[model samples]
Target chain A: MKSAKAKAHTNIALIKYWGKKDPKLFLPMNSSLSLTLDAFYTETEVILDGNLEMDQFILNDEIQGEAETTKISNFLNLFRQETGILTPAKVTSQNFVPTAAGLASSASAFAALGAAMNEVSGMKADPTTLSTFVRRGSGSATRSVFGGFVEWQMGTCNEDSHAIQIDDASWDIAMVTVAVNTGKKTISSRQGMQLTVDTSPFYASWVETAATDLVDIKQAIRNQDFQQLGEITESNGMKMHGTMLGARPPFTYMEPTTIDVLAAVRQLRQQGFEAYYTMDAGPNVKVLCHLSDSEKIQMKLKEAFPNNPVIISKVGGGIELLS
Target chain B: MKSAKAKAHTNIALIKYWGKKDPKLFLPMNSSLSLTLDAFYTETEVILDGNLEMDQFILNDEIQGEAETTKISNFLNLFRQETGILTPAKVTSQNFVPTAAGLASSASAFAALGAAMNEVSGMKADPTTLSTFVRRGSGSATRSVFGGFVEWQMGTCNEDSHAIQIDDASWDIAMVTVAVNTGKKTISSRQGMQLTVDTSPFYASWVETAATDLVDIKQAIRNQDFQQLGEITESNGMKMHGTMLGARPPFTYMEPTTIDVLAAVRQLRQQGFEAYYTMDAGPNVKVLCHLSDSEKIQMKLKEAFPNNPVIISKVGGGIELLS
Candidate 1:
């Protein structure tokens, strides 16, 4: 087959995916689903070049660091070994998230990368198949392959666990992301989850209960019930943090400003605005508001927190090839 | 009425009492209550002595600090005005639990003081009356006036809200308290609660939901269902901490050692032991195990944490005058 290139965009989980049952296999403790926003996504291009010494990866216009680079390289190496491609391959990527101040952008970035790579390799693969490759890259990234509303099926094995598109999210739901990156994080999510797995008393409880919430949240999204979705996501995120609090040393990912943003969101909700927020590993605030009311909500939040500029976007589509 | 002396005790809520509608009147936003355990308790003896110039307060064998002394003296001044009592009173309190250890010993201690003072003043008052007086001293202290399974009614006015006993633990449940006083607390519960009320989005959520849980937990206790009660208390405590974590600067009462103790408790539970822990504002672990199984739970915890000594006690009764 002739060499080809494919560009794919990333996605984000409004209902965050956390807590893995098996970290080695990236088996999630619960099934988490999300949406693919048009804004704040990754654009990845895969080139099948048989002349390279080794498979190459360039993230966001820069060469990946030793540790991170090795991870991506290993993923590519494994893929190459499976395909029996004796010659190496090369991959290039660029993340369009300006400084990307949190909100699990890497999930979408890598998932998009996997989708683009699979397509360029002449593979007629579905999201689940694409997810298998992304899972080797990052667990949450597996969910980014499908657009609209997507679900990460946390199966028992690598063959079964994958991402599937749930809905197109072509409705009036709006998302506003606020970037807040102060400096280096005290602890990474990897370390936090590991600590929770090793030390938290409620880890089992979390794993047991999260599936129910995730299922309910997916149904809520399908129903386009913003209130239900928001409430469940808020509770699910808090419960995940609850497990973190029970972890040894108990590191909290929430920042003082994040609390302020959440308070503002609740205040907006109380003021008859259908607004809710979900957070990931960063200090940024992403609000799920209605498109019709987005401007007003954004203006009020902007007035209150003029220092933090909010980026507004509607429901985004799934990963696709560059025309 | 002749001048006399009497002793009293107060109860402390594991779920905190926060956001007073009226701080001076000590009107809480919601009703809170707790069990007045036998092992860690407070004793207060009050003397109606005309010889004293004013009502003097002593805690843990030391004269009250300047700020605390002022706060108490002001409360007493108000009480005396309301009671129309001419003679000055003296209050002495001894806490079985250590100071600044996150245990709400002060709550029970102060409640007992109010009861004892009322008795010595020739005011033969019921628990309701005692709760009113104690509420003025500290919102949580009023709950300590009742023995087992007490609920503090968040009364709107001075007449309606007070602590009431739901049920006396004639049942078989026991609590093993692990007192870990690493050092003086960096944040007092009062300050922490204030921060939470002012900053946390979950604060309103907690305030709205606590009453329901409070009622449900009371029912759980009445049925003598250790599993239900343990689950409810742990969840309630977690909900309470949720607000704290969402607070600005996010003060955590959870120490590393506290996590260790919690893991030990859960490990024991997994081993088919009837043990679950509920934590208040401190780093200590209060394992709510069955009275029949206290020794085994304690031994298991001791095995996990050799440095800390666990005190196992059955459901303790309310305070009484030491004859």
Candidate 2:
């Protein structure tokens, strides 16, 4: 068996995916849009050989436990089954981004893994096909397989529910990520999504509105309307968090730093800077702005949160086979 | 001219009123439910005299500014119109609760003023009519006119939209108010409500779900189901905040200490204390639990927030006039 290595960058959702229509199949309830970023990425190497007795997984040079390895093994099994390769695989992965901190590290992780596994197994699947395969491991990873602007369509079936590139995102759009909390969250996105879906009274409305937002955002992207895009992105992200707030025994992911960053972003906008912010299921906030103003926005955010890591990223490319 | 004094206690909404269908009339877009608390209240004295040049308003032993005086003057004018009394009035009010910061001080303030105005004008309006009059000043004040559990019905017109007692709340229900922030909020309730109504995409859904929550909670109150009531109360409060989150240039009222109090409440529930928390438009959180557990919850909250004020209150009575 041949070994393959690949790298893929993380993507931040402009329109979030909050709930699963079919948890077992990993089908989302609403379509989502995202902007793939260059600042954070994951690289993975995979080797399939008959000599391997069991699958092995290593993350960031540390050996993973059975639970973590088992997840990776199951994901590889999808590619193995497709290519009729019964040999166990050894996978090594490294992340440049903060893992499990609402930064969409999984988007890069699974996207790279899928690309590497596909190459090792000689599947030679196209990007769209690879996205469908990677989505089984992480839903947002489907968008990471494409470059720049991507949209994941929440189709009725597994075969149809795949992501596609919407734009090259070669325009002036960029993001300033404020890493407020790099620590792992108490609740995972998977667990949080399930809780919101099962208990939130606003879940149905979230699904409906997210679809509308998806449509509006796509139009804004097509027109290169930065203001409209930023507005919808901010609104969509809040709607996703809103659903979580309405969940039973309601919880919020926002910390004081999250609010502070948001206030700073608002202040920046008031100062004539065209900046808007969006957050995932953690304390970190990502400020969307024009590429030309990214440095100034970063400076303002750094002044407000002097201790936190503030990084600026432009649009990134899709998964690539390194060697 | 004869002067009359009346007192009314503050009431915190379990199902919140987020927006108004008619801003001019102070009519809410959704029905809301609240619990009248014994710990916080306001007293006001009103006197209508033909010799008075204009309305004079004093609050907490200090002369109020023109804005506050004008608000009180306009509220008294409602009674003037009803009773055909052209004379201006002198209104003096004092609060037992923290004045803003989500303590629902406006509930008690306007309820007391309405009761006093009703008596001085010789309108002799019933509690329901007085509630409607008070609602024009503050929406939550409509519920404050009644003792125990009250529901403000979101009627189509001003004549029909009023508060009525849902339960006398003679049961063991009580609240431990954690005054996390007593200072005035940067965003007032009136301004926040307008922003949410005009900007939030989820505002309509908030109205719809709040109506349903009101129904479910009223039934829970009737059955005296503590767990159900607490669950609905917590969910409703979160839903209200959720709408605020989705507002354009989104904002949240939750502070770091507010989240700390919420976590403590959840911890108490996890430890089988049957405690649940609800917040208004500020950082303070009110833990709803059995009257038997109020002291214990208070102790735990005090331990968690050593510096903040923690007060326990049971079911309070309706507005009453003094001779």
Candidate 3:
């Protein structure tokens, strides 16, 4: 048995990926840019065993049900198809992230799984091949395979719709994650995005504006224009949620506390700090701000929400083979 | 002094008019539909006194400031332009609505003023003509000139963009006004609409979809389809706020309590009552439910926020001369 262990940090999108262009292949409707965070991540180990009748999937030290295990097995089958390696594999995964509340956990889960499977298969594939392969598991996992600022390009087909590292993000940027609610999400991002794509009247505009935002934010990052970068990020995220509100049976990820945190972040700017807020498809809010002000922002958020966790995170590294 | 006293009820838009295609002329970018509520209204007395030096504008009992007086004066000037009345009228207006929140006070205010001026000037203007006249003062006021479900047609020219009564609304539909925040609105609906038009990436789609929803809701009203009517109204209101969220330096009228009320409304539906919530440019929420269930929904909302005012209202009449 050849076993390999790998880990990948989670990434929070600045310009979000909300809908799928091709859900079957996990192709995004638009290009998305993200900042990989140091605090939250996932690690997975793959064991290639020829004796096993089927691939066994264990998450958090417990063997998963058939439905859950089959997802991993299907992903492993894709790996075998790509690498010409046909061996049953046992996969064990653990998340350092919080309770699922739509935190892009599948991103790091699939990225780590794909990396470990690649290692065990002895197919020393390049990072691009690895990212594209894992994208079939989850669209956002494409960006998690790379560190710092990453962009998942909305390619025309399966081959080019992969993520690339844009910047090292080793500068003055940081994020404060206000985990307002960590309950299992009522509407998964996959379901929400499909709903938005199928029914939201504003979705076509979202697809168009998100593409333009990606270009502008890339320029902002190149110039290190923090203000431009933050503004584009915040507005792009709002537009993503905006599309969901126009769906047939409209929905919102913004809970009351999510709005409270957003107001506090705006107040930080009023008090002369550079803090901007963005929300994915959940009640939680993530603030992108200066690394120097993270402690102050965290303290202010703590004052507002004494019970909830307010975490400060800096730029993180990409996926790696664990020692 | 020939004084005419007129009273008009404020209307809550179901298909909201959020932007201006011709802002200067107060031509809305999209047509809107609204339900005229009987509870909150305004009364205005316009005296065509040519002996007065200038138009004296008094709201409630207090004389208004120069800016406020100028706005009333300007609206009156347009009234004079249309009717050949050059009188510098003494205008006294009183609102029965709550504190100066964005509760569409201007709708009733302008409609009452227009009706009073029309009476004093002896223009003998029909309802359509009167609605067109008041639209210059406030766009939504065009709808306030009628009772029940009124549709403010988004005409290309000033002569045609007036409201027409679509449904008498004497049926099963009713509304519960949940006053989340009656304090003065930070961003006036006028300014917010312009901001959305100028910067919100979602505004264009809003324009297109709003037009579609207006048509669909009108049909729903004609058929007395409560479910379809409620769905369109809720989705339309959400789409309106969704545009504001995508605006540059985004803003929202939903406070924490506003969301609380909204959650309660949705919960009522889960408990098998036909209820739906809608919001405008302020933190207040208004729920449209079955007239039979208004009391139950209002009671639940009142329990959730005992300090807040929850008023139940039914279909109201158009502008009328008060004895």
Top candidate on DockQ is: 3
Q: Give the DockQ-based CAPRI class for model 3.
A: medium
Per-residue lDDT of candidate 3, residues A85-161 (tens digit): 88889899998887567578888999999999989998868998788999999888999999999999889998899
For residue B198, give model 1's deviation from the true position in Å. 23
- Per-candidate interface DockQ score: 0.06, 0.60, 0.75
**lDDT of the structure predicted as candidate 2:** 0.89
Error of 2 at A193 (Å): 1.4
Q: Which ten residues in a row have the lowest lDDT in candidate 2 chain A?
A: A254-263
lDDT string for model 1 (B1-323, tens) is 23333343434464557677776788888877676676777777666677777667788788877687676666666556666776766667777766667666667667667666666665667878777887787777777777877888887799788877788877787788887664678788778778767765556657766787787777777677778777767766766765665554444576656756776777787889877677777777788778899888888777877888788877767657663
- Chain A structural similarity (TM-score) per candidate? 0.92, 0.99, 0.98
| Model 1: pairs clashing at backbone N, Cα or C within 3 Å | A38-A316, A147-A318, B8-B112, B9-B112, B10-B108, B10-B144, B11-B144, B155-B161
lDDT of 2 by residue, B1-323 (tens): 87999999999888888888898898888989889999899999988777889989989899989998988888888887888887888888889989888998999999999998888888989898788899999899999999999989988888889999999999998989999889989999889999989987778778877878888998898889999999999888988898887777677898877777787888898899998889899989988989998898888888888999999999998998876
Best by TM-score: 3
- Candidate 3's residue-wise lDDT over B1-323, tens digit each? 78899999999999998999898789999999999999999999998886999989899899998999999988888877877778788999999988557678999999999999988988869999889989999999999999999999989998999999988899988899989889898888889999999998888889998988988998898888898998999999998988887888778888988878888889889999889889988999989988888888888888888999999999899999984
TM-score of each: 0.60, 0.94, 0.98
Question: RMSD per prediction, one decimal?
Answer: 11.9, 2.2, 1.4
Candidate 2's docking class is medium
Q: Judge candidate 3 at residue A66 and give its lDDT.
A: 96
State each model's CA lDDT, in order. 0.70, 0.89, 0.90
Q: For candidate 1, lDDT tens digit of each residue in A144-223? A: 77677888888878888988888777778878876555355666667777876776555665666567777888788779
